[model samples]
Target: MPSAISRFAKFAAIAALTSATVFASLDDAEARRAGSSGFGSRGTRTFQAPPVTSTAPAPAAPIERSMTPRPQTTAPATAQQPFGAQRPGLFGGFGRSMIGGLIAGGLLGMLLGHGFGGGFGFLGMLLQIALIGGAVMLAMRYFANRRQPSYGAGGQGGSFSRSNSMSPANNSSFQIPAIGSGAGSRASSRGNRPSDEIGLAQADLDQFEELLTDVQTAYGAEDYATLRRLTTPEAMSYLAEELGENATNGVRNRVSDVKLLQGDIAEAWREDGQEYATLAMRYSSIDAMVERDSGRVVSGDDRRPSESIEVWTFVRKSGADWKLAAIQGSEQRAA
Candidate 1:
């Protein structure tokens, strides 16, 4: 036995080395466990703690959890696709919507025809507005663009009547008035005073009959040139345009059943050393259409005899020679 102090020192040194060796061994074992089975422990043989280790909290339990496969959330998304893309009904589309609205309104009107007082029908209201408004607009536009027609006495083919020209005789049977003959004096007084009244009343009446005969003859013969001579320039132009249109459209109008109803001089006056007289004549005729190619009468407005009244004015350059100046006629269409 050495000194007591020396002996105590040697014992302490040996105890210290033993504790360090135990610590080193525990670290090696923990590393091995962490690398392999992840959780391993060693028993303590003495009063020393098992090991010194970092106190890092154990990795949080994996956030992933067991799934119950809830009522197919993804399946619901697929089921909604077809319904979202489905097309609309016909009446719901833009182009056909107006037609649907009209039909619906009409049907509603029919159902409520008796319910509403005074026969207020939906379709009737719409139709009335359309027709009336359209007619008014058309009439306004036409009147705005048109001027009144003017008439006067002018020479035929820019020349005076010739003495040798053959025409209906004066004082002849053809010269007789169609209406009450000599009574023309009593029918239309030339002057307000009884004295200056000219016996031209008979002459005026005769002039009317002649004018009508002239028109009928010219129309029958399709003598457009002679018709131009008898009618005003405006009237002539209108007829020519009508004929041109008919030709372009390939149509021919036929006439028949010609009858003279009445003829009388409406007025008579003297202008520039010439006698000017206006005649009123009434007549009836049947108009028929003929095919340009077949000569067959196809269609016409005068299936039933149509009546017309013509107002004609004539001028005479000399005593026995007379020619038409202005002529106007109105033909009412048969219903």
Candidate 2:
């Protein structure tokens, strides 16, 4: 029985050792892919949104500006008619006179014993009074016209002159300032103020390419100081965590021969006093992992280089140096 127990203890020890080695290998592989270009969290997206601003784009592109001009127009002024220019009709001035004459005629007819009704009733009396009033009005109008001076053709000429005096001028001029000119002035002012605009110069673009290489070199060499300087606080934390995991598993990732194959701007914009740029970069590198003590190859190929495409986002304040803010993979791959 004692011999049997000794054999079981030996078997258990071998099993435990094998499990530890397997776990260590798995941890190293995970650490290798942890902070790779196609791995990790993409930082906060401040510009891309459902809530749009003046400078935001309908579709993603480089170098978007908000200084477009608006159209200009002028509405014509309308002419108003003079109050006294409206002429009166023939009965206009004799309304009260006609009313008085009708009443007087009715009363006279009643006193003559031919009351409101005779051969005709109240309607016949009203009709007779109306005819008498109309004749009297016509005689008065004729006398009044006879008293006034006659000017014939010359009177018609005077009427035209009065009409000309009453109507307003037809050719009035109005000035509407051009909106395009104002927009040009605003654009010039913005050009003079560097802070208002966020444009990437050729030199700025070169720096981005240089950083792509420098960051990879520093990370491979386990240079935390260089990583901190080249990346944002959030990105630094992620890189640090990955490196810590690799160290704990007694392994290290070695990246070399890093080269940018192709690159282009995906989108760039300025917001909240900061400039942000997202770039799609295709690169090739020799990426591999090795054990800490014996330096045995644990994962990946050291001699064979691999190519990958990734989207990287960088951000900086006005007149400040750019730093890596986020990273995202083009294709999802299992670790």
- RMSD values, in order shown: 52.1, 42.5
lDDT, candidate 1, 265-284, per-residue tens = 44455545666554444455
Q: What C-alpha lDDT, on a 0 to 100 scale, does residue 95 get in candidate 2?
A: 47
- How much is 222 displaced in model 2, in angstroms? 0.4
Q: What is the C-alpha lDDT of each candidate?
A: 0.38, 0.48
Top candidate (TM-score): 2
Query: Candidate 2 residues 1-335, lDDT tens each?
Result: 85674455345334433433343243234323332222222223432211111111111211111121222325343555433233233333464335444444444454453643357744565565456545645654554444332211110111100000111112211111111132123433433211212456666667777778887778778899999999888777766776787788887777777666555554466766778766555566666677878878776666776554445668788778988776544431111
The collision pairs in model 2 are none
- Alpha-carbon runs more than 4 Å astray in model 2: 1-197, 332-335
**TM-score per candidate, chains pooled:** 0.37, 0.43
Error of 2 at 77 (Å): 56
Error of 1 at 223 (Å): 1.9
Question: What is the number of backbone collisions in each predicted candidate, taken in the order shown?
Answer: 0, 0
Model number with the top lDDT: 2
